[model samples]
Target: MSDPITPLAKANIPNPKDGEIVAVAEDIWWIKMPLPFRLNHVNLYVLLADDGLTVIDTGIYSDHIAQCWDALLAAPPFTDHPIRRIVVTHYHPDHIGYAHSLSERTGAEVLMSQIEHEKSMALTTLDDVAFADMMIKRYRMFGFDQDILNALAERGNHYSDKMTKTPDAGYIQAGDRLTSLSGDWHIRCDRGHSEHHIGLYDPARRIYLSGDFLLPRITPNIATPLAAAVDDMLGHYFAYLAEMLTWGDDWLVLPGHDWAFHAVSTRAAGLIRHHQQRLAQLLDHADHAPLTVKSAMDALFPMELNEHERYFASGEAHAHLYHLVKQNAMICAPDQHGVDYYELR
Candidate 1:
């Protein structure tokens, strides 16, 4: 079940530098903003509206990025047209980080799904110490060592640092049609990567602004945030992938990261296979021996991980284990140490 890994190649869209805006499609501008992470950048889009421009996602809030926005707003095409509304795809810090700032600066309305808005509001007002304590408990349940718990407790408001305040937002839902500057855009609420993540599709143009639900080269990280405590994150992810597979193959998927791609069906299938293989390995390991989430993660993700990445790795390991338990492929019990152990059913 351990399939050989093949690198995914993106479509022929050039990588844009920080503060650079590239015209990826007609009347659509791709703006890249820097993130202080390995992924490094998020793609924000600008769609030409009738009298002004509508922004897709706002980059993380920072003075440096603010200067970039100032420059962009003062530039030729942007100067001629003001930003009227800002629509965010999800509640991720990078996507909605600067939404409030931009809305306040330009008096632009913020639009997002109701669940995402509620989750974002929850995250923005989270108590750091209490959240860290909760994370420690979750990690302990997943069999994380005391060292990891200490590191997590010392993490010190890391999540809040990346985000600004969430603004008053209007709600969007699945099957809703939003009339934008381009045309009527259909909203699709996809879960898994984030709760109720919204992706906009333009039937006339065959274009989909897919956010984190579908990326060009990499599968989005599925973590169990306190705001979203679903045990079946991968299940939700696969459901979304299967749904995307039914979409027409000619769609130009404008992802939150990486280049815009034409083969979403192919990408979705590849991601599905990847997860299926992971689940197979997980099942095989559990069949051989009862294991904790930490042991399972060690077997599944062999690469070395930093303290921050450990959080996602543990959550993803729990996700797979939870999926197996839900499917009755595995059974779980608490060990003497009060940690969960899973074995094949």
Candidate 2:
């Protein structure tokens, strides 16, 4: 049965506010840039330094975003200094979309984690035909219908134009300390969410730039993508949570998607508990009978679904099921149709 589309779109809707520069500290400011996706904004940071300015996380490479950057640079706060460096938190399109262009314009050297830089460059050259075929085969193995599978195949091409060109240069590895106008920021790297997602911590100010690792209102999506060896994403996610929890509760969190908050410990605890609840729910469903990934997704997200939701739902379900299988709490057996049937161990 095809699910309705209304709830999916509504669930992923993005809320954009009037653009403003927020002073995070004495010489640091954050600018929220617009994006085209349902989660329609990204936070870009600017640091006023003695030598030059540093801009972090340029917005997606659209005409509108380019104009926004131009306007801001022309304004008073940013008019004096040239951008000496562009520090990207990760390689996501929303985070590094205008990196190449901005680096060219400002002569800023782009800095990112080595793992993120390699992954980002690979995305730029992904072959559409091969990618679509892989999506169809993966969905078929999970028991999605032809219609839903077809939609998933074409969705990637839809957003290809929004992706920015890869950076001219490469990345800065973890354990490298960044010194600028704001002083030294320590880089901490973790996996699970995205390969080698980098978070910056300034001990002096007790602030953490926690890219997509932590969000206030919504849970971060943990999906099992094709051609990835780390199939147990749920396990990796919990490990990442544990790593972040060690940063102490009092530190202010600067997230990629949500507003800045000081509840790092509380938010980390909540995320861990949320995943526990999701695992329990999956276990209960598996105990009743063997379930296909598609059926499990429908059970977990029992609302109107669309092409986007369907794609995400399958990936999320696969992540959880793979984790449970690894822990011996669930067993997956292949049927003649080639779909995996999962049940409680």
Candidate 3:
């Protein structure tokens, strides 16, 4: 069954019906698609043009989303217009999963950051069993018990499962401007969330298509890569947020997950505060005892999490601890078991 479209245009609809596309402006449209996570949805934008349409951020690959696309393209607004190019903001599974699928359908060019494209390719070649075993070993080093390790191994590589094979992509970078009938969008790239995350801003319209950069309600997950915990991922995130504060507060922020809102500086400041508080929490907990990533995770986020949540939570914990290490507030040294643990300096 096709999902029904609502009559009204939504600058901000908290939750539109599935497969519905609402107008954000005169020509641009917004659609929310289902995601298999706590966040639950990813926002996709369609820029209309007489020549062709430009899609910002493809939703994850799945049967249901495929149906939604079919219904969307077959309808008014989206009908007849070709998807000229797909501008992917990042390489997260939910954002880039269907880039190739839609590109294959519409004969559209896929545009992505070189870093994200390479990361996607590397992730595609990752063997599930090998990935699971490697994660088990790393989680063990982070002080995960055998039970959590077993659950993680069974989970395997969700990214490989969720992400469709990437298509050949044209590279976009900072300072590049994408011109279309709708408007000119300036590209800005930052590090941390994924190696190089892209955000698009339209100066004319004052719209910021912020993908996982500064979410409205929840702070975006700042995670260290599983292979190494030495990188200051959280620090990078803070630096990016600080830079965003200077971008002014008048821009309308269209985030990847949540509802659209204004006040970009306010959102950025709140996110910075959230992480700072988390860092403080971790620092105080470590003062009580030498802590592993697992211990820090429980202290910072003392809530029940399923296997999937655990994976992200572990990285978040390591990111904060390692950021403190970089700040010289903490030190990471291996214990007698060769397990890395954090202690106050």
Clashing pairs in 2: 4-305
lDDT of 1 by residue, 1-345 (tens): 123444346667666788888876666888988877777889998888677788999988888778888888888557778888799999888899889989998999999999999988877787778768777877888898898889877885566677678889988899988665566788899878877899998999888899988776667876555655655777889898898788846888888987788877877888898889889999888778898989988987888888766767777788888888888888889888779999988
Instruction: Rank the models by lDDT, top first.
Output: 1, 3, 2
TM-score of each prediction: 0.93, 0.88, 0.92
Query: lDDT score, residue 317, model 1?
Result: 82
RMSD (Å) of each candidate, 1 decimal: 2.3, 5.0, 4.9
* Model 3 residue 122 CA deviation in Å: 1.0
User: TM-score-based ranking, best first?
Assistant: 1, 3, 2
Kindly list the per-residue Cα lDDT of model 2 for residues 1-345, writing each as its tens digit.
Answer: 122211111112133353556666676777888777667788877777788787878888889998888887787467777788888877777888899899988789988887778777666766676667767778888888778777766666432356667786656767888765666888888766676787777888787787887776667777775545647877888998887677666777777876777667667777888778778888988878888888888877897876656667778888888889999998898899888899888
Clashes of each: 0, 1, 0
**Candidate 1, overall lDDT?**
0.81
User: Candidate 1, clashing residue pairs?
Assistant: none
lDDT of prediction 2:
0.75
